[model samples]
Target: MGASHKKPSQDDSNLEIYSLICLDPSFHNNEETVKAQQQLRVSINYLKIFENCYQCEEYIRSVSSYNRFILIINDELARQIVPRIEQLRQVYSIYIHCLDKITNQQWAKQYLKIKCLSDQLDMLVTRIQSDHRINDLFPVVIYNTNELNFHFLYSHLLFDCLLRMNSNNKNKFISLCKNEYKNNENELNIIHEFEENYSANQSLSWYTRKSFIYRILNKALLTQNIDLLFTLRFFIQDIYQQIEQKKCLYPIRVYHSHLMTYEEIQLIENSLGQFISINSFLSACLDRGLALFHLYEPNDLQRVLFEIDADLQLNDMNHFGYIKLVNYCEETEQIFFMLGSIFRIENICLNDDEIWIIQMKLCTENDCQLKSIFNILRNEYHYGQDSNLLSFGEFLIKQGYLNEAEKYYLRLID
Candidate 1:
C-alpha cells in the first residue's frame, strides 16, 4: 500500500504522479529485493529518462531505494514500457553495494509483477492457433529475457504444446511452430525443442530431423532412464560409427559406461563388437576392477589371470605388470604367480632381494627344477629367513592361500 497519507503538509500531498503502479502480489523476503535491485540498477538510466518526463521523482526515489517498482501507467504506455523494463531487467545488473537498501517490500512488488507477466504471457499464448503470433516474439524471450523481445517465444511455446498434445493434435502445434521458422530467417526451434522435450516421455525420433541426437545422447546418461539411454544408443548407432572413426570422447564415454545395461550393451556390441578393442575392454576393466573380487571360485580367478597373461605375453608384446606397478620384477612375480596358480603351490616366498630375482627368473617357464625350488620356498623352515617373507605372503594371498599368507605377513609384526 502507498504510505498512508498523514497530511503533514499540503505541499507534499501535491506531488505529481508519473505512472501509477500496483503490485498484484507482494514479496516477503530480502533476497528477492537484492535480485530485483541487481536487475533494475543496470536500467536505472533508461528508467530515469521516463521518470523525468512524468515528474515521478518521489516514486522513482522510493524504487531506487531498494530498487523495486510496480508503477502503473496507461495500457498503451504499458505495451511499450513493460517489455522494455522486462527486457532491460533480464540482462542488467550492478554491484550489490550500489543497491544496499534492498528490502522485502521492494522485492515483493517485483516478484509479483514478474509472476503476473509470466502467467499472463502463458495464458495469452495457450489459445493461439497459428505460428504468426509467435513468429515475432519467441526466441527472444526463451533464451534471453532482454527487452521482452519474445520473437522466439511462440516457437518454444508451440513446441511445448506439441510435445504435450496427443499424436493427432501434435501436428497442429508443430505446424504452427514450423511455419514461423520457414517464413522467417530462424532455424526451426525443432532441434532446441527436441532437446528440451526428449528426456520427457517424448521420443528421440521426434528431434532427428535436426541432427541433435548427439547432444541428446551425451546427456542421456543424466536422465536416469535406462530405457531412454538404450533408445538414444539405438538411434545413434550409425552416427556412433562416424564418431568412433573420429575418436570422439563424448560418444565414447556414453557408449562405454556400464550404466547402459546388458540390453544396451547388446545393442552397441551387435553393431561394432569386433571393433571394440581390448584397450577399451581394459579401460573398462580398470574402471570395473572390483569385478575381480565378485567371482565365486578359483576357476574364475584362473580364467581372468590366463586372459590377463595372454594379453600381456601376446597382444601386449610386453609385461603388463612392469608398466602397472613401479619397481616390479615382471618375470619373477609374473611367472611365480602364474606357476603357483597352475601347480596349486598355494604360496611363494621371497625377501626384497630374492623377490627381484624370483620375479625375473619366473618370467620364462622352467620345469620341475624351478618347481622344486618353489616347493622349498613354501616350506615352513624358510618363512622368516628374510624381509621378503611379506612379498611371498602377498603372493600366497594372491594365490588364494590366505591362511598361509597371513601367517607370514603377521610373523615379523608378531
Candidate 2:
C-alpha cells in the first residue's frame, strides 16, 4: 500500500486496434455515395468519443469547455494510412474495403461478445459529421437493396453474443445497461439483445427495452442485426399471445412491444411525430384517444382498452390519462370496449366470418345503452378492401339476421 494508483479514463486510453474502413474508388465520383462514406467516418468518431467515456480514459476534457479534436481522423488521411483495401465475398456487405478480412471479422465479433454495444451506432453519424468530405451516411441506392448483408452480419453477431452470455454474468450485463443507456441512444441495442436475454432468463431486466426494440425494427433495417430481427418477429407475437392467455401483470408491455417496430417508428419520425402500430391503432380507438391505424376486430380493440385501463389504474402509464379524464362511463365506452375486444387479430386470422360477425354486432343491435352504432359499423366495414365481405355476410345469415346481413352482400356485388 505504498502508492494508491488511479485508473485512466475512457478518453486517454490507447486503442489496442483500430478497425479501419475506407470507400471504393469507384464510389468516389458519385456525390451521394461519397456522402455515405464521410457519414460513416463521423459515426466512427462518435463511437471513439463514446469509448473514451466508457473506457474511463484520463485525457477527456472537462464537460463545461472541451475541444472536439479528440481522435479526429480525416478521410484523405484514411486513404493514405490504409495499406490495403480488398474486395471480399458478397456475404459481408455491399463491398469490403479494409486492411484485412480478419479485421472485419474481428469488428463483427465484438458486438456478439457484449450487450447493447451495437446501439452505440452514433459512430456512423459522428464520423459522417466530422468528415467534411462526405455528405450522407445512408444513401438512397442502399435503401433499395432487398436484403442488407452488412446488417445481417451485425445482427447475427449480436444474437450470438446474447446466446453466449453466461447465466452468472446476468447482473453484470444489467449494470452495464444502466450505466451506458442514459439517453434515447442505445435504446434499440437494449431491445435487440438485453431485453431478449432478460426475458428469456427472467433474471436481467430494463424498463422499456422490449418496447424500444419493437419501435426500432419497425423503422428501416439499419441495425443490420438479421438474426435478432427474425427472432424478434416471433418473440414479440408470442409475448402478446402470452399476455392474452395469462392476463399478465403488464399487458401494455406486451401489446406495445407487439405492435411497434423500428421501421414503423422511423417512418413516423420522418413523416410526423406519430407512429403506426396494429396495437397502437386499436388501443387508441378503444381508449378513444387518437386513431393511428385500422383495427381489424373487437378483440384487438378490447386488448388495447384493457391494457390502457390496467396501465392507468395501476399508476404505471397515465401519460394520456385515458382512464382519468375521458368519460368512458358514457355510451362511447360500450362501442370502444366492445369493438376493441372484437378486432384483435393477425393478418392471417382476419377471416371473413370474424369480420362480418363483429360488424353485425355493431350494426343490427339496437341497444338502449348505445346510440350511433351505424357510424362505427360503416366506418369499420369499409376499412378492409378485401374479397371476404360476402363470406362475412353469409356468416351473419347463419347467425339469424337476414335483412341486416343483406347490406354487406349487396355492397360486395355492387
Candidate 3:
C-alpha cells in the first residue's frame, strides 16, 4: 500500500452520483429554490438550477450515465422538454410543479415516467424525498442456490477480509456524508453529532439512526457502489467488531419481517435444504410478535418473515450477536448480523395468515460445502485472509469490477 495514512487525493472526492436537476426558470435567482432543496433534503451543490428548457436539456444530456437526475420542472417547460428526455434512464423521476396542475395532468398522464403533478412545492418536495428514500430502502441482492452462483462465497470471504482491516478514513467518511447532506439541515445536524460523538462502540447506534448514513450505506451494498462502500468500511468494521464482542454465547432464534418480491420468495422456496446469502447487514428481533406486527398486507410485494436459528456455539459461528445496548428500539430484543451472513434454508411455507415464513439455520465453518468453496476462493484468488485491506482490492479485481478495483488499489497504494 502507497502512503500509509496519506489523505486521499482530490481525484477521489466526487463519488456521489445523484444529480438533482431543477429546471424551473423562476428558480434561476430565487431564494425559494434554496428552500425547495432544503425541503427535499438535497444539497445545494448537487441541485443544478437552470433558467430555460434549452439549458436544462443540455445539462441533462451532459451528465454522465452513472449519475441520475431527479427533475423538478414547471409544467410549461416540462411539456416542452419531457418528451425529449422522458425515455432516458438518467432522468430517474420527473415532477411538474406549476400552478395549472389540472391542465398539466391531461398531458402528463400520457407520459409513464412523470412521477407527480403538483401546484404545491412543499407537498411535491415531501413526495420527492419520500420517493427517493423509499427507493433506497429496498433493492438487496440474494444468492440463488439452485444455480452455481458464487456471490455468497464471495460475500463470506470479502467480509472476512473487512473484519481485520483498519483505516484512517473516519474523516473521509464524515466529509463524504456531509457532502451528501449539505443543505438538508436535519441530517446535517445528525452528521455533526455523528462526527463529534462517534466511537467504535457507537457504530450500531449510528447505523440505526433512521437517517442518510444507514440508507446510503445499505444502498451502496445493494448496488456494489465501491466508492461509497469503501469510504464507509471503517464504520462497517466497527459494527462487526461490536457484534463479535457481544455475540450470543449459545444457540438463539430471531425473526425479521420485510417485503420481499414474489420472485425472492420463490427463490427461497425452491432453494430449501440449500444455502442462500443476503448481501447486506441483517437485523432481527427476538420477539416473534414484533416481527409479525411489522408485516404489511401484500400488494406487489410478498410479506416475508425470516425465522433464523443461529447456533453460534458451532465452530467459527460468531457472526451474529444479541445487542440490547444500542439496539435502535429499546422495546425489542435485537440481534444484529454482519453483512453477508450465510444461512441454510431449512424450510419455506405459508402460514395460516398467508405470510411466507422462511426458516433458516446459520451456517458456519463446520459446514463442509461452505468451508470447501470458501477455502477454494481464499487460496485460488489470494483473498481468504482477514489480515489486511489489500485482499479486498484483489477480491474486486476477481469480480471483474475493473474500474472500482483500480480506484480501491490506488487508495491502498503508498
Candidate 4:
C-alpha cells in the first residue's frame, strides 16, 4: 500500500442529530443542568432550548423535521409533555434526560428513555446513529392512552405493511385476519354493540360520522378488502347522501376504481343521476363502465350498452368508450356489438393492422356487401400487394362471392 488512511466513524458522519433542552426556570443556578446543556449543543447538529414546558410544546409543533430528539427537562415540564407523547412518537426517536426525578415514572417508561444527568450524552447519540433501520420501522403505537383512539392507526399500519408484502405473505396475512376475527368474535360483537349505542347517544352530526368512516373506507380500498368494503357500503350511502345534498361530483369520482356488485353500481349511477347534468352524468358513468361490464348479466349488459349508445348519440360525443368495449367483446367472442361499434365510429380508434384485421374478419363472417369491402381495401388501405389480394379473393370465395373473388384476381393480375 502507498499510504494508510483512517475512515470516519459511521455514527458521527452519517446520522442527523437533533436535541431539545427544556431548561427549568428554577434551575438557573444548577451546575449539572448547565453542563448537560453545553454537552448537548456540542454533540448535536441542531439544538433547541426552551425556558419552560409551554415553549417546548410550541417548538415541537413549529419544528418541522428531525431524526432524533434529546429532551432535558425538569419533573413538572415532563408532565406537560405527556399529552404530546403520541404525536412526538410518530416523527422522532425520543430520549429524555430529567434533571430531577420524574413523579410519573410509569408514563415516562411507556414513551421515553429517562436518563440521569450523570449519564454520558454520547451514549444517546451513539444509540440513535447505530439504528440505521429507522426507515424500515413500521408505525406502531406502543403506549395506550384512553383519550387517543388508535384503532384507525393500527389498521393503517397493517394495511401499509400488507401492501408491501408479496402475494404469499398477503395470503398469510389474510389467513391471520380470518383466524383473529374467529377467535375474537365475541369481543368484536361487543365492540360493535358499544359503537352502535355510542353513536345513537353522541352529539356528533352524521357528516362527522361519515368523515370517520371514510378513513376506514380508504383503508379498505387500499387493501382491496372487498368484504370490508361491502360491510362499509352502508357508510358509503351516508357519504352519497352528503354528496347529493351538496350537488358535488367529487365524491362520486372515488367509486371509479372500486370493484362493486352490479346493484351497487346501479345505486351509484341513480344517486349521481339526480344531481348531475345529463352530459356530466354520462361522462362520469363511463368511469365505471368497465366494472359494470364485468359484473352485469347478459340482459343487463345489453341494457347498459343501449343506455351508453343512447347517451353517446344524444350528447353527439365520439364513441371512445366503445373501443375498450369492442376489444372486450372480441376477447369474449361476443361479436354482436363489434360490427355496430366499428361502424358507428367512422374513424375507428384502432391501429391500421387491427382495423384491417377486424374489417376483413367481420366482412368474411357477416357476408358484408362486396362493394363496401372493396371500397375499404382500395380507398382506405390502398393495399396493392399480391398476397393481400389473394387473401381477399380466397375470403370472398369462401363467403360464396365468386364474382367478387374473380374481380380481386383480375385486379391482382393487372
Q: For each candidate in the order shown, give its overall lDDT on alpha carbons.
A: 0.25, 0.26, 0.69, 0.32
Q: Model 2, 93-141: lDDT tens per residue?
A: 1122233444354443432211111112244335333332221111111
Tens digit of lDDT per residue, candidate 1, span 34-118? 3443333221211222323134433444332112233423233334344345433221111111112334224334422332122
What ranges in model 3 sit over 4 Å off? 1-29, 42-116, 129-139, 145-154, 167-169, 225-227, 260-274, 295-302, 315-318, 325-332, 346-356, 381-410
The candidate, 2 or 3, that scores higher on TM-score is: 3
How far off is residue 141 in model 3, in Å? 2.0
Best by TM-score: 3
Model 1, residue 55: distance off in Å is 41
Q: Which sequence of candidate numbers ranks them by lDDT, best first? A: 3, 4, 2, 1
TM-score for each model: 0.17, 0.20, 0.74, 0.24
User: In model 4, where do residues sit more than 4 Å from their true spots?
Assistant: 1-17, 26-30, 89-103, 112-414
The positional error of residue 183 in candidate 1, measured at the CA in angstroms, is 17
Window of ten residues with lowest summed lDDT in model 1: 133-142
Better of 2 and 4 by TM-score: 4
Q: By lDDT, who's the top model here?
A: 3
lDDT of 4 by residue, 1-414 (tens): 000012111122112323444445643457755555444433332445667767767666554332335555555666677556535621344444444334446566665244323134445444443331221111111111111222222222222222222222123323433343343344334335434543321211321222223223333433323334334433333333333343322111211111222442343333321211110011123344453433222211112221222222222111222211112114211111110111121121223322110110111212232334334444433333433434544544655656645654553443
